[model samples]
Target: MFSADTEQWARDTFHHSELGDRRRSKRLVQLASSLANHLGQSLVQSLKSPADIEAAYRFTRNQAIDPQAIAEAGFAATVENTKHYECLLALEDTTSLEFSHSTVRGDMGHTTSNNYSRGMFAHSVLLFAPHEQHVVGLIEQERWTRNIKDYGKSQNHAKRPYLEKESYKCERASRAMETRLGEGMSKIISVCDREADLIEYLAYKTSNQQRFVVRSMQSRCILESEDKLYQYSASLTDAGMRTVQVRQKGGRKARRAVCEVRYAPITVKVPSNKKGEPVELYYVGCQEREQEKGLNWHILTSEPVRSKEEAERILDYYEKRWLIEEFHKAWKSGGTQVENLRMQSKENLERMVVILAFIAVRLHQLRYLGLNKEEAEKQSCEMILSPQSWKILWSKQEKRKPPKKAPSLYWAYINLGKLAGWYDSKRNGRVGWERLWEGWFILQTILEGYLLAKSLDL
Candidate 1:
């Protein structure tokens, strides 16, 4: 069962969204809490009763529930929260939400493999607290289903307007942020991968006085000559060396890669088709000095890098971009299982996507909160876990005696991880998101039984 406090928080977070009738917005909060509590469960299981399921369908089908309005409400809350922090990194990226099986009443986009799939491409700006290294949540998101007829059109050597191209998704995402938060804030830096290295986007950001760090994708002419980007960057001496952690992919273990960092200012010639003048930008490059094939990142930023520390700082912001991808993982399969939603219309699915996306960020936050032992010890477990949850975990995991006060949240998470099959050996390391959530769901189930028993005694 969902706790009253959790339900109230959901309502408060979504209160700004005007979904036709006020009652509809309230229903949305109730439905969202249910979805979050029963992560990976189908809508029927999450809603529990037949009456609630029917109501959910009605809410979903309502044309009044605009995805953009609801998204803006969430974004407003994020902006308000960011007012307290001096610096926030707005990590932007795009991900495809596949609903290939659903015969929704609208056209869908092509998946990464160019397969015919029914889905929406979401270009989003995920906010992060730079110093704390915690994901603050998404502040902006733009969704679109591709018009398949336009697919091979860009391949032809044509001088199409930037708005006519599909790559405009990055520009739209950045513009949405600027529209909401304005320019010259100095507190926020937009971060993106190589896909966002367009001169037009960089020029727009600069014109609007917005800070950004985008990994370079194009090797266009630079410095009023034919100097290639790679050759020009290679000529510059190394600024410094740093060890960075790289995530594992395709059966490889996570490891650190040592790389030398270099930075230089370059002027990229504007594409003749576009109206913008030459865009002068700084390039920060990192090359791995290790095995045959490893990590190499060439970044372009609006922020000037005068020293190694400043360049590393920009790279650090880019590192936070991975958090947004992890947010997608948590949204898709890891936690909320958004793709399982069976709504039959594009409008309905988009509404649910907005709600689930925020919930996924919260779930990711929960998994990260209790990981740090030192910080967790200084805080009360009740801040995250309920009293019953910590007590039950302490009793079951410790086996002999329960502590007078609840165990620290970190210890509780450790026990929760153990419940999910993690061994106590040091080599086993800390709990991961997959196992931690597995234990969390199991605990919620056991807590339902414990509550039932208490009610019987009463």
Candidate 2:
């Protein structure tokens, strides 16, 4: 989605990467191009030549190559893209990457209390253009392996310094974005889940004048009032009713939930244990009026929520928070399958994961392109697939000569699902990421063959 060809896009994305040596930066671009072209595949399968694969290993194993430098180039590219938009939603969340292989287990930390389960945690901030309803790119990401000894220290969280806590990742990312975006920081509205409701994090955002909509996890005391934050919110008059699409989680079926919206301005007092001043913020509450156990959202935001429309807008921004979760799935299990890596060293693993993280974002962008049927139909498939790629795909799917003009993105998207053995029927709804990437894999294979044939003039 960034460019017409994956190789050129990789160059544009990583050419400026400060990887110590110029050759290393070039190798990074080449490696990223190869990985991007054959996404969701293992290293051996993705790299075309044995020499290229060996070079990739050497690049990652190089002690001087910093993983953060590789990731920073991508973040730089994303920041440049963000400049074009007037406003964007910065969706932030954390996910774990677990490696169960015996070879890599020793280098990793425990993902859970089970010492055998080894992995690292990745906290990412994915930028989205709310107006366009599409992903921009990953602005900030932090990957760290947990100390195995600290696996059972949840009870001692409060005693630990704020910077040492895992929750600090969110605030750290915000600071990074602020540094990177500079003047553009005002254009961003950070949308986060309940985990970001920490008093320190909220206070930091408020002090920095960073606009945000965070789901409330705890009801802190209200300044100059007897009622707690949630209790005060409940007492406000119902502003209006909003119909929201509740996504399916586990056994719960996806359905529409009509929620009663209530909002008010409140000043939250810092707990006696904390050292921050009282922060004034708006609280937006949504209680489902239909189902007994329907969606209930307690939204706390720095944005103004004076009217019903403003309150609903805050909820909309909060709802976009799901995109980050989907992004994590795409990075870990759905598409890239980063956990499948068998790198022997944590350094090598970190380098590889940093590269694959960008590929996962590209995969997510491709799938997101087709989500809005109307917009997909109007847009050309060239927005994603290259001319050679789409032409071959069209010929294969239509069983005829390729069209002179590129087809609609929706047509390409649907047919890609068909290529991956998806049956279009009333029973089957929209095509998922698995099928979409499967289709992309098949198409890439065909495109390679076509290019080879044209090279030989056969």
Candidate 3:
């Protein structure tokens, strides 16, 4: 899904972009290549020469360059890669990109609970191959700003048209993916959090025959039974017990908890005021059997869950939804530092954000590959690093001559962590994206000097 060569990947992604002019398209490829090579660095730090830095700034400031056009190129590339996979999980979520700088804030809208804070909301649909255990690419990204004047309009949400509401982003993304993927739409199963439990959204998916596994938010009315959706779900027979590993969030410590699984097929009635038909779907309920703080999931799905294995598969699909959250962190703070961008105008800020979004996916992919021991051991380092890069990294880290044969990805993963000052111990947790990128940054800097010296033949 991703290439080892930064320049080649950039060219393949943005070369055919229709950005008004051929020169603009060429500049997009060059700028993306430079940014991808540098990973987390800012524009001034990423571009080696002053001319390149100035060109980058100029490219962003161009009014003719549509941010959506830039993003569409990458989306097209992702759709092409989806052809190889038999099944994919399309994870959707929204994140706030806050730019609180005085110069840029006025150009943006309010974010989170703070009216004083200004930013834009980026809703992304990231494609992942479940069998491969790797991110394919970002197929859809919608960037928008909330009007500051409408800060206190929550009470009027029901009165507003569905198209005008913020929640429409999810449905819009689904439509975009369907149009883009065309015949490949059947291969994808949409996975989303509680925010996507809207009846309109679910109805759209079900009516279109789009498969989905969305966490239940509303205890909806059931057509056949007197009990509501959750009540009916609780009354179903317990299928079995399964242990699930919980990731640490906030102050919670990581631990495994046994959960009781229950599943049933139910027909959900549309709300009284809303004009829609009752939607029939499968429901899977998972609650921790014991523990003060435990895992509980009220999952709603279009996929059939007739047996324990099928119910577990639904649970696993929802669990992978956390990848989008980690991706947001990688984009905003961890890897890309997109929020740190100092573009003076909203247009330029969005232009840079779209470009960096792809880079963040690459960073997420690298960390994923490093963590999977089996996959890393089976593949060669050449899948991620250039010949000169692995050879140089080998010579520098091992304090010996470079080997003629390439090393395993596991070897490169461990040594990269070491270069970033990570202590290799079972007591220490897995290497994070930050540390992996730090090691990569150091290697790239050294590779630059090595290539320079070789060019001089000194």
Candidate 4:
């Protein structure tokens, strides 16, 4: 109806449009509200001027969102989003974006931000829901006085390094999910790669403390059985079944029974390479057993893994992490250059990460809506949106190309939008309806005459 009222929809989506300098300017909010009203889905002119965006921030934050509403919406959305992806929830910790506004190193060191010409840093977290093939949470975080370190290298078998900033961000996302957990929601199994071996993660899981499916690093995880944490263990076997998980890139993921070991409980100590030698620490309820040749199934849990099938299931869940890796590819590209954003000041960079995260979440909603067979039939609590609402929320699609780290789901919405009202061809070069009709007829005539004139080009 009337092109789906895009301008109003965009305005409403962003709680407020508080572009800083434009507090008094009337067009700031209008322009911010007009993003969805722009040319195409996978395209947009990022509001560069701080004055324009500060107003947008205030407009959203100051709009009087009830804490209760956010909490309720959070729970509802979790339930709705997870309804379909019941088996696995992929945990992702990657540098979705990084940029250093300054070449000089300070606290966070050089960053991988888009606007590196400015002193800024960009990093993000994305929760990939594999069953639905859409991002569950696309969160962004920024930092100033950056000391971002690359702790990917390990000196000993026990060290693990984690960014303090990322810890907080992951927790925030986890808390947001926790507040909504078990409120008629499907069970979720989170899978992460090596970097997530941090104590904060252990703490994060213990805090809300739901059962999760996680992977172990080659050197970082110290398996503990009877007070002694063992390092360099391969595969797990118990509970009347034999299974194997190989991480060193086996040619194929042959899931048949490979080998087995009499698994025992142990605390997997994560080694930290900073300030000293490898330190050994252990969390309770992790076990080790046997499986295939290279597959090390070190089961870390609050409770003993009950069966081999359960153990296989955990590794199976961890495999889902690859999906999040794929998502990072789309999100960091094209129109959504959340990673490419170069910030002059660190504060602005941080804000950009937060905003990008917010953007990712909305994009995820649209993608999920487009994929669901029963999108029209299903509804998520205020947190999760229905396909009907997706039509309104799908405002962020790109027309020409997918952005790096951009989700294909955005295209789904854009295609749907085209059906609704958005057109790809330029609505230009024609003065009016008569001109448009005449041009169309002229094109037809030219095609018809092309048999001779077009071929000869005389």
Candidate 5:
């Protein structure tokens, strides 16, 4: 819990956001806190009472709770937090908000998969403090419903400027991060997955002196090598080895993977139309030497990768990029279920979705704090939660009176994991964002009740 009520925390978090009227801002904060409390419930189910439902609708209809304003507030907080870190890692990615089979489908755009699927594409950058692996905040978010008519133009993308292409989302996100982060930071490395390997984006990053580690999806041409990018990387000597913890997915068992590390400096050839000189960068490859389907990572970075330690650092940052993907899961199915909303107004839905994004980030950061027991034990739950909230959570989790001193944030999450059905003896390791926030939703209700009782002095 923070120093104030959770609703007050919401207001303070969005303090730089302009929502037209002070009353409107207050209502937005209240609504956000209420929604986070009832994360599993629908709008009507969460509101419950007629008066509460009416208030929620009134706030939604106010026309002042702009989605851009909500995102701007998050961006401001991200910038503020960056001041504390000399080096930060920002993970950039995109996910679709599918609202298929809905009556308001026409308002939403077509997803990449099928014409029938309708939704908006959410492209965002999630900032992180790499030292502690803590999610610092959300840097910026851009949402756009694709125009079906222009979808064909994507086929002829080579003729068009990079800005006109759909792939520009990567560049847009990176630029926004640089502009927002400003100057004075020792390092700000933007990490992205395969889809972000664009010549233009790489050039922009190099010109601006911004650091990045983008997973290479293209078998591009490397300077002084007849072989393609992937082939050339394969020819490099194995620099060293690192044991990476690979999370289970797609029927794979969770295990510590021994990855063969390789690194080399490469001059990436630029596309003719872009009119830029060849860009000099490093290529780092990480792969398990002998699995049927080996865990492989081919990364392109602006930073030097001369040593084994540096190559590991590059791979480490790319691994952190998976956190944002987990973030998208937490944003959607895990916590908000943003696609479940039946709101007819796309504008209002966007605004509400942005609010849920903030909540998702908070849940993510808290859950990650529990990863390192020594580090987590040093963190006070009270600093992160309100005293009333923690007291109620402790009471329910311990099945006894509240403790005089606040429990470590790690213990709070451990109790939360139990509440959410996570077994301590499970070999899969720590509980994920899903179970963490699921338990948090139940805890929020207890917090609400405690706040109400204190107000009434009953």
Candidate 6:
């Protein structure tokens, strides 16, 4: 369906291109084609040679666009489209590629004179929903000033570009929030790890401003005792910990003891040790979650956890960040043949990831979303169900009634697997939309047959 409007969309995001621009003059499409192929591929390793422009070009044709500039144009369009639908939210940071390889070719993706090769430093952010499940944003690096250490100048003009670091979080997030504001999105919350604190989140808060649920970095921004200066660590490892007993459920004896910990606040100077110039603020880690076999350290928001209920809710939804990881896995399941394409530049690769991530996520959401069902026709989401679904679900819901504990989502997955006939497959883990549809149909059939049997008996 997106194919039908491909031409019009391309035109809106271009320059130096007339309808007569050789059908391949748009630089953005060339790049976006690289991205789309990457999205369609199973994994980064299996991407066919980048020299195989024929295949990439062919895919672009199917989607109805010029291959050469697809990546750039597509990214712009997806960002705009997401704003059109109010899907923007906080995005996760980039997963460093080739950072561990100790490569000699250290110029490509180094830390701007940090002499990091980090050969082929590509791949950027994957935007997602309010839950950060599916990607709704993609920010790639094109002007990374490694050897030169310059992010270029920004001017208010049609062709103005962002400084390299500006693309990180603050600037990109500001753009996203503004876009959503125009689209009328309410309750936007930006979540991130320690790296995002430098971005001016508080300044961007709209009267209906987006709230930051970002974790704090231990640095120049962090404060210590008497508001004194102390370098904070990224996590609880440096938080000075203690262990105390707490409640545990489902034990031989109720309220089994577990370890509790505390950490006082501190400050961390950024650039690690740059005197007189502060780059980060740390809140310090305060607690440790100890286990019998191992241990895991944790940190809370730099700001206070005002209400326990809100704190619990934050913890609950934060887990949703994992969904994007699984989404990336599924997206690349075929092989990152696209990654191997070796786009003209690393920027192309980053652009491709964001564009594809957005499409992959959109496809996922469409399945559960109703096309035209009125509010009343649908169940209350957690409790709402189709009449057919209700009949099958009600019995099991009744079986575990009263004193029985509520079932976790595990039951939903298990039942769907059985209903979809996925129980026999070796890769019986994730049931795709096809299988979900098969399960729903099967459930509907079973309910009908049982209802018929009862009527005859009566």
Could you tell me which 10 consecutive residues in candidate 6 have the lowest summed lDDT?
1-10
Model 2, residue 135: C-alpha shift (Å): 0.7
- Least accurate stretch of 10 residues (summed lDDT) in model 5? 1-10
Residue pairs with backbone overlap in model 3: none
Model 5 stretches with alpha carbons more than 4 Å out:
1-5, 45-52, 150-154, 184-186, 272-274, 450-458
TM-score of each: 0.91, 0.97, 0.97, 0.48, 0.91, 0.46
Residue-wise lDDT of candidate 2 within 243-348, one digit each (tens)? 8998877798888888899998888888898898988999999999667877889998999989999998899898988888888877887788899988889998
lDDT of 5 by residue, 1-458 (tens): 22225566576667777777877766777777777667656768777578878888877666756789878886886788778787788888999998854666878878875777788989888888888566888888899898877665566777887788778888787777767766733368889888889888888888878899999988888785989888887889988888888887669887888888999999999866567888899999988987868788889998898999999888888888778987888788876787887776778778777888887777667667777678888988775667877787787778899888888877886877777787867764487666777787777767667778889996
Model 3 vs. true fold: TM = 0.97
Off by over 4 Å in 1: 1-5, 100-107, 157-159, 183-185, 224-226, 251-253, 371-374, 423-430
Better of 2 and 5 by lDDT: 2
As a whole number from 0 to 100, the lDDT of residue 416 in candidate 1 is 76
Off by over 4 Å in 3: 425-429
Candidate 2 lDDT: 0.87
Give the total clashing residue pairs for model 6: 45
Write candidate 3's Cα lDDT for 1-458 as tens digits. 66789999898877758998998999999999888888788899999899999999999999989999999999998988898899999999999999867778888988878778899999999999998897999999999988899887867999998888999898999999999999899999999999899999999999999999999998999885898887787778999998888888789888888999999888889999898999999989999968666788899999998998999999999999989998997897778889888888999999999999998988788777877888889999998899999998899899998888899988888788778898767654377777777888888899999889999996
Task: Go through the candidates in order and give each one's C-alpha lDDT.
Answer: 0.77, 0.87, 0.89, 0.40, 0.79, 0.39
- Model 2 stretches astray by more than 4 angstroms: 425-429
Write the candidate numbers in order of decreasing TM-score: 3, 2, 1, 5, 4, 6
Best by lDDT: 3
Error of 3 at 455 (Å): 1.1
